[model samples]
Target: MSTPTKVPLGSLPLPLSSHTLTKNLTPDRTAASPKAFRQVQHSQPSTQRRARLLSPETHFSYVAPNPLPFPFKIVPEEGEDVSPANQAELIERWLAAREALQEKDITERSNGLRLHFPAGREQPRELIGLSETGLRDCLPHLDVGDAFDLLGLPRLTKDPTNEEPQETENPARRELIDILSGYATLINVEEDVDKSWAPWSLRYSGHQFGTWAGQLGDGRAISILATPHPSNAELTYELQLKGAGRTPFSRGADGLAVVRSSIREFLCAEAMHALGIPTTRSLSLISLPELPVLRERIERACVLTRVAPSFIRIGSFESLNPPESMFFLGGGQQEKDLEALRILGKWVGRRVLKLEGIKWREEGQAGDAWGRQLVLESARRNAKMVAGWQAYGFMHGVINTDNVSIMGLTIDYGPYAFMDVFNPYHICNHSDGEGRYSYQAQPSVVMYALRSLLTSLSPLIGAENALGNKAVSPGWAKDMSDEQFAEWRKQGNDLVLAELEDTFQDTCAEEYRRLMHKRLGLRRIDLDDESKLIRPLTSLLAEHRLDFHSTFRRLAYFKPSLVDSPASTGNLESSKADFDAFVESLMALTPEPQMVDTFKAKIDWKKWLEKYSERIESEKGLWDADEDVDLQRERAMRDANPRFVLRQWVLEEVIKKVEQDTKSGRRVLGKVLQMACSPFEPWGAEDNLSPTDILDDEVLEERRYCGIGEQQMLGFQCSCSS
Candidate 1:
């Protein structure tokens, strides 16, 4: 197909500025450029940037990739069109676009780094996607030869020009991968970033397995300060230093992470984000050679940079001196703790949620009007986030209050898994002994967590300052009896939980139904359609022990149409023969034949297929009525259900390869990363998008082994030892 020609809008050549990973593409060498290099000395993170939010002036700060890969580059002249119409283009076109440059046209210069915070103030730098910077070279795949040591990790060793670190902070070596993997050796934590910028610890309270665990805070995770993103200057990220050091919140163990756990998080974080799931983005992952920690065995230390708008959780509100305890006990201290909590709540709401009118100037009930609205917004985002999790087979092993993001992104990725099998009750996290955070229980757990948040915010909702004043002769007023108090109590109950529960239930159901509709390729969602189609498929999948993703892909090949039922035939033997033949025909459309057949052998596929056929027939006229309907239906279904999910077996094999040969391992991982990251690319030349079709035979053979020694990964035990 010929690519569509795009009309140019401006004559001003668009400059491609980036601190990219270098790749020696010449004869003897090949390299991948990291990020854009920032020359000039250290600058304060003050709001002293030259550009502001949504401004037309494209500054040096907005140079990094936001929705796309950071390490990629763009040049002047013929800019690439990334519209849906050009989705079928080769991946190499993107790789070669940057180097397709003009010598004189490209003016190489650095716009001395800009800061977001005020000058000369110690601020906390919470680690984020370790924006690619300072790396003179990029990492080679497993093809680099047998090299499995800390030395092979990607880092910024020096400036390419060997320019003295005059403008940029002394061009120091930055082993981003190892640093992010929780290795403390790569970065110099002792170096003072700024007079005002200093690392700080976060503290909050949360429930673990339905039990409230008090004073759980950032043990190893410390926030340095919010820095301007490579893409957006107005949007700042907290550069959290996870496993950097010990804080008061460091419960009882040393603040460090293991390589095994670090790599898993690094891969899963990007994988989730690529799949369009709201999650904390990972910038870099690094491993330390000699730094070993005791878990189940001697595992090397690793660090990961998990980037987010903010790391605040639902527990952040609960930690406030809440009025719930006082309301229940009656008569309490008139402390201003709840007032502070409300202030922070407003900041989070305005900064992140972009909701207006949160200023707490109003007195009494008016001062806390945003409280109920806050709960509703939080509920809506969490509902959608969890729904994404459910659709993609993500099992967040630990769903504690602290683990739940106020921003509604997946946080604290410990023992989480993109499940291999289609068991609704499957517990991916081994630490979740009671299965409270299992695949099926995610929605309920989130709802329950929200309810707790409401309980913590009750004080700000017109509950009067009860310090020492009250209608008291014996704690009761003679003018107003218990009747007046009872009325007040009832009104308070109405303000907190009543409307909020309705909002939570409605939003969750709506989001979930939206996802289900997509997965089933159904245009409309109703009780009839759900009962007749979606729900039945879910039940049948669980009963058959099928893989969720593969089974859905298999269903994409068949379009629904009303057909003669075998039972309609008068001859019983003939009917049986018809049923068998029907099943065989339907099975022919199946993807991943051997795996599907293993599950099909035990199930009543004939009956299930009949029900599904009836469903498609119900919507025969709604959509897919044309002769090309087969193409349209398949496109819709494939769009809704991704053929690739980061299954445990696949990830485990990749991990093992990395451990054996980082060179070859990196190459295979790069291929896997492409598929795992973007699941919605247009159909390739082969008319098949499955990675199993494209990967090397060795890798494909290993991917097929779902069993871990003896038992399958469904029973695999993973813990939060890191």
Candidate 2:
């Protein structure tokens, strides 16, 4: 196929200002002649000498390839006038427009780099028949390579700028939006894409597993690809490539992601997002037929286009060489760092906590009390994030500095699992043999990561006063330092650490209480006075070995309200009620609660009821009746009280499906993906309350085998079954 020629529609109507080209591009070495270079450079009228230096050669050029590979069709909505011809024309026009921009020679003078989007050798699979909105969502697949390109650099061609038009209605805007939206929908991705892109990323380095690595960047991911939302143009969905290729920070390793790992990542990302956890969404999962990666064994390679509010991690800033110099004393670079920090802090405050700008201000504070507010907000979000993880029984397995998000969203699903059994010390990843990231240790792991981040931010904020301006403020005495900032950070860290310990203690106490209540046939104790509940519960558990889940679920039914309520129990004495009804219902003997024996259990029922009533009365006295209690706080406490865990049964169901597929040569991978995608929901229709309907021991054992050796077992099964 012939390369499409650029067709210039018209020049930009506005007069080009010298300020437009603030960053100078490097000269092209392959310029046909110096005169040609001068002609291109001098094309724009440059009133300022600095602007004259920023010739077209300094600008980066990127173009979409013609004759896309994917088969797609456009389906316009009702009353929409987007005909097939118009759709084709729109695509053609887009291709032509992009080509024109790419052909323009751009240079980066400081780096001596002529930025050019050299067309990829292979054409991407073009998806058609999508509406403009659909196309916007699907752009991730169309431009997978561009996602990888943005990984290494601090800024992309389309950097977030204050002067840029917040909204646009042109064909370019429509096309881009449609493409991105389509990408998101096609890949079943769902995360708030509006707050996804960042111009100048926060740069930092990290100590990976204790080794201080300097200048580590996006090794195999990029974020240049973004399409603004069609309806709200200010919102954009970013397309970041994972395992697309290598960057300056590849660290000698091939930046290729294997298909198995890619599948796991893609599914988990979407799953986490669906479960209402803040996380990066997977827009597209593309298998690279041409690339076979060797990791443990040779496997087919794939690239996942992941969309996130921003890819800025604590490690990003830590990896930079001379991080303190870059922020405090550096030239123009410090401004970028400061801006990034502020943006990150604001995002944590607003997006995570739902806090408004006005709430950040303090009564006595002046000049951006937002920083202090930000620290508290970050702490709250981090605590809640831990709680969410606990509720789902999710073990991140590797809560490294690089893996944690400033937004407190869980990203990078490597070696992650939903816990099967409630073993706090259970480590999912065999590689983490040291229990660095065990189920119970995640809170501590997260705290450590946050401390490292705060440590990195200390210099910028002034280590002494917990205020960032002290180091840079001229009014401060030369002798005065950020010593208070250091102390404040230590205090903040201590508070967070203490909170984590408290949370873990509560978790343990709650679990132990439930266990006791079940085995000893004791009524569930109110945790208002944890010491009272904990002492009795611990004693009961020590006295008798009992299953945790069974015990609590049984006791939950033994409520006095059921037997003593006037409406239901008025004629109980005349009806000759027996305790069998209570026992059978309490034991979950019948699927339907009404079918159980009608007898009310009388063994110490009055005593237990009195204790429960007394606890309630005591709580009311302890807490002022007039005082408004935060219902959300109470709900959070209730949620934290270990209930049903989705991971326990979903894993079993997934493993069973995998086993069946392996044995029967049937493709049940979709079901597995579905299970992972909605980790919180039960599988199948019959067992909506249960994780999975399958309960046979033999089947479970087979499924367990399938899960452990999924890749090999599936291949073998496919071969034999076929």
Candidate 3:
């Protein structure tokens, strides 16, 4: 309940020159911010920025030769009558092809997971039917920021672009809503004029736990449109309708997403984006009251349209080179599969990674050397991404290789949670019985994924050696004996893995240190800072079961200048009292109120404050000489420590309230989204967006749903059944 006021000290010891601090913060004045510290700006909503309106009649132009450049199966022609009987016939033929490829000897099956080869790499076909016609009546909840900035649509209520009659008026707005609702389609012709774009799902495989989970792909997700970035010409946006319908990779279960999970995915993606974490963006949430999807219970179905650079993942590569245990289902299509891997790798390198010319192919480097660069770049990006997750106390419950994005953006929001209490070993997914993807294990798990990616890329890496410099040849394996080919693959993977592992570890550790430094209001971090300050802070919070976000936020109020003042200055006792107040503030948000005094007595505040104060004093010169140093440091720390996170408890309340009353719940969702979009600012602080809603008093007020939950709700976990 108490807040610490700033205390001033004339000078501090070991202060570096202002020049030195300037260099440290901005080493190259002309260059951009370090990639490790970069934050996404599109997540924020601004009235001044406007984009072109998206409509069903508008052609979704794709920068790629083909929006989806993979082999696919043929289905009922657009005009053909796909009656139940005719559909059954089509399915039978598809099954026969699958049986021929699978050879019928492989009996191993769970969730009907099996390899599905396309009839041929020819015409693109519609994989599945859309949701029932009843969905057209529902309206979608669109993120104003995403609509305005990404899709070039005006906000219905509060955007300046509302003055534009066409954007604000009926048919255009209705058309946008229909496309998002999955009732209407966008025109497909783009740069690849000859290619017919259709709704398609990707096929891939990955490790579920630690073992290989064969043939896991997009079950409920369907890619429908690919459009150029509204602002950036070089960038292309691929929008996918998650929970759209079924595809070949749906396996046995019905491909549907429940309302609870869809809401979570929609909110968290924007929330993470607001937090400056690299992640996919949500365009809209279309609720289907007419259709109920059975998960653990019968819940209303919802379709979430998510936007990303590309949905390719580490598993995309792995799917091509399945384990030999798959009975070599790609046996007949081995060369074709290899070619697919090569093409996929090159596309990622050129488009996603943006490597090119000398950067893409160094002089005399193997033609496929970009493969290794792709792996390292992916490692670097992921290392920074996971480090951001760790610093913010986020645990992505299901980090299967399939969920790991090649672009290092956070994908698949299933069973994910932000830390309530600072428990290092907290498992957010109840289904994760082994705690394999726990908060503490995330970095190591990422390393596992990178290695899996490297293994998948081994054939491409070994192409030159296996083909005797004819790297473009797909049947490189045919030239060598099976043993020789295996040896070459192993050697290449080992070499690449050795280098990749080092890059990942070193990058992750460095990025983690940088983020931790920013979070703690420190401009400089020594080698011992982790042991003395960072790890100790973690231990102290876990020991007290203290709230993670609030603890760091409260520390911003503690004045480093006043800590350990000299007796001669007559401020020593007050300084010690001030530091005690800061410690009490940490216990202020603790769920175990009765244990607060006990925690205070147990923690070595004297020792911890000494180290923290000293570290702060060392970096004192980092502030501008003319500015107030404490205020500068406090602002930096507050920016790094968001006042609000899309906590699991908050999400639960929002979901419940929405089910109770649709209109009011929609308002609540928008209010929370506004809060999430500008997390660093307090709930009522202006960010040039929407005004504060009265619902904040009922929803975010203390003890209503504000602080971390108590009891079982604390560190809440969920089943992946959603």
Root-mean-square deviation of each candidate, in angstroms?
A: 17.1, 16.5, 16.3
Worst 10 residues of 3 by lDDT: 6-15
TM-score of each: 0.65, 0.51, 0.74
Q: After superposition, how far is residue 82 of candidate 3 from its true place, in Å?
A: 15
Error of 2 at 321 (Å): 8.5
Candidate 1, residues 1-722, lDDT tens digits: the string is 33222211111111121111011010000100111111101221111111122111110121111011112233323566666675334233332232111122122212211112212212122111222211101111001111122123221122234332122221112222222332221111112222111234454566667766655566567553344343344454554555544444444455667656766776777778766678876655444444556678866555565667678788766655333332221111222243446455555665656555554433333332455677778888888899889877788898988789887889888888876556788887777778999999998999888887776655444233232211111112224344654454345346767777787778777877888778777776777766776677777666555567766766776644323544555566766565565555444433334555444543566667777767666666777455576577778888877666666766677666655654445444545555555555431322543655765443343344322222354446578762
* Candidate closest to the true structure, highest TM-score: 3
* Candidate 1, superposed: residue stretches over 4 Å from native: 1-195, 228-234, 322-336, 357-368, 463-493, 561-603, 618-627, 680-711
Q: What's the ranking of the predictions by lDDT, best on top?
A: 3, 1, 2
Model 1: weakest 10-residue lDDT segment is: 23-32
Sort order, TM-score high to low: 3, 1, 2
lDDT of 2 by residue, 554-625 (tens): 444343333443455566563235333553433342222343233332233333444543453344434335
Error of 3 at 147 (Å): 8.7
Worst 10 contiguous positions by lDDT, candidate 2: 713-722
Provide the overall lDDT of each model, using Cα atoms, as 2-decimal numbers: 0.51, 0.40, 0.60
